[model samples]
Target: MPIIKLSVSERRRLQVFITCLLLAMAAWVLTTLSGAYHFTIKQVINFKNAPQRRAFKALQSDSVEVTMLGTGWQMLFSKVNTYNTPITVDLHTLEHSNYIALNTQIAQLNKTTDAKHRIVAFTPDTLYFDFTNRVVKKVKVEPVLDIKYQQQYEESGKIQVKPSYITINGPGNVIQNIKTWKTDTLRLTNVNDVVSTTLPLQPAKEGNISIYPKSVQLRIPVEEFTEKTLRIPVKLINNPHYYNVKVIPQYVSITFTVPLSRYTEVDEDFFEATADFSLWEQGYSVLPVNITRIPAYCRIVKTAPRNVDFLVRK
Candidate 1:
């Protein structure tokens, strides 16, 4: 191929022509995007103002395809931004009718968005529901916890939840099967002090089930623990013969961990060490010292002289 160089004036004219073509394309894109257009998008449907006299379960899905009328820019952004605010429909009409007309709620739905974006129609114009007898139930609230305590620290007493129970109203079949509702998992790491906070309960899986007092107050007592050792006498059990049996070591040293608040309250009386003679009759020479009873909040560390020798006298 032969190399051909263009003149300065010809080069300048070519550049201007290319710039004008680019400007025209930009203007066309802006004009088209500014015009009004119609688009369909999926939206979640939420219910409010549920009827008090009857319980209902939706027969159709909780989502519907909504046709919206807006400018091209709004439609483009709506598709790019996938967050669509759920449309809430009032269920108060359900008391008199079994279905809800979505057309009647177009005005309310438009309020949830900007004035330029209008809800034109819904694919399923009407929502149907199945009615049932409503019932009330009282259920206990169970807390779920994932806690990591500092060294030598633990829960001191029982965890208390204010409003230990909550009221639930729903279909009889559904409410009867629910015995306890749990709160969202409360997580804490390296905890060194009492924990008092409010946690929301897990949301109901079935939309028709309603829980009152959505959140509860939690009071967890935490304390630093220290080891305490006490000598507790071992009591003999199942000694029906009434023979004088002498244990080599009559008392055993019991070591346990107790919270600082109740360290002084617990003593030898708070524990009971027992040795069953029935084991000796079953052909054993030694009796195992078992700490049968201990303070509920205390954890046993060790019991000295786990096994003791005994001498039988007629």
Candidate 2:
């Protein structure tokens, strides 16, 4: 590296130029700090000491315009950060009307600002608030599901909800009409197995409400089902004492599809097939075999020999 050394006369001239620039900068700074400047800032209002089982809703906006007189340096810093510290309005200090005139409270804000700056004026000098009685209630959670299963797979049992319910707190007028909270729509395709997940609850479109425990878990049971067939005997029912009728067919085949869990529980004895003689008519000689009972879980796929001929002996 090559260094270029300056002569004494040249260095003295450079030093004088630097000194004059520093002096001018200091003079400008002092002059700017001496004058007062006006600025508009946003001061958020916080509600504290609210009554139990009560919510405070300010009828107006939560922010206020606070015009203050301050030096240019103070205004510059404040403008850089227009968000001032929040001021508290204690509900315990309000009147029966549930209103607080903030005109008296501005003095408290001035104290929190920079000591060199003066808060000359502000708008909304006063604000109105509505204190509503908070009502808490538990409502059922509804799942919105759109699911498609793959071949040979289907839902086995009812969809189970973990929480089942949610607690909501809001104004009485709004909470009174809330019957249930529904979750957002869930879409799934080719679901071959169980779907266990947590879904977030959607806010009610109509009211201003707050829900606790925002999300709930859903356990969707799934299984594969195979076709099952059973043979059931046809018996005579509601027969008159004078007439004894015997069905031409002694047994009928009942084919159904049962879930694997209930495969052993469903059988011939689990169902009832009977031909009611009372239902017999003169021209209608065909005895209709009525399926009086079947397992609740199994779906009946088919029944053979729906009707049979009967020989009556009196």
Candidate 3:
């Protein structure tokens, strides 16, 4: 192959082009390395689950300062990009944990990457995070329990569950000196047969403690189906003294569906079934007879609403 050669003028032109390109590249490098622009170094603190997070009672330092090295473009975009969000380490989690310099964790935040992809680095070679023991406020723990009542019995009966307290896990200062959690009064009224329910646990008024399990299991003892009948005493209200009127029916049949535990509370003699004659004077042709004063745990299965009709002639 024949050798190729360049003329003098062509060579000179090529030299000038190379010189201009190198000078332009040098200027760009100097612009970045001048370090005239001010940059911010923000300490990053990361925390998960912001919604359910517990607030810190105290921290050694709220803010930290670091020297940043980067171009103007990198500094502006750094604000939008998160280096880290504040973290609240439960003091309890730190129990039996020592020789751990908190500053090491803070240093991780300083090396945070910039959003603008600038070749920037942080100064001081490390970050400082000062965390002090905080005074935390106490939160109440609410427990929920499920219960099933005995058969053939209404739910109006009272129940007792031993050791109704629960343990709460949280910051050390919060759970360290805590004990006992209570449940609210369970209200099951006039419910016959086996019943199942979840009871909410209530916490004592004191230090802040959050219960791990919001609900608890409640199993109520139930008795099999049983039938009982009693003769209830009848009482009358607003009897007319002017007219000789008698309560045609003196006794009413009282039946109840109750658990064996509550059977003793029922008193048939206490119940009074009566039709007020004054209602007739008030232009009432017929009075709707109803049973009053039934056992709290008992239900009226068969009630004699119109057991008897009285004939009164004045």
Please name the candidate that would achieve the greatest TM-score relative to the true structure. 1
TM for every model, in the order presented, reads: 0.89, 0.51, 0.39
lDDT of 2 by residue, 1-314 (tens): 53968889989999999999999999999998778888888877776665555655668887787787888877777766754777666565543556777666667757776677877765887777676778989999999999998876777787888799999987787788889889988899998888999989886543235688889999998877778988899989877675867788889998887778778877788999998777675567888888889765566778898998889876
Model 3 C-alpha lDDT per residue in residues 1-314, reported as the tens digit of each score:
53867789988999999999999998887676544455665554333221123423323333344445556555555578543344332244333332224344444443454433322343333323222343333334333434443445434545534334555644556555655555676666444454445666765332223454566656454455455677664555566565555555666666656656656765665466766667877877656567866655566776554554555657
Cα displacement (angstroms), candidate 3, residue 153, comes to 5.0
lDDT winner between 2 and 3, please give it. 2
Sorted by TM-score (best first), the order is 1, 2, 3
Q: Model 1 RMSD to the real structure?
A: 2.5
- The top-ranked prediction according to lDDT is 1
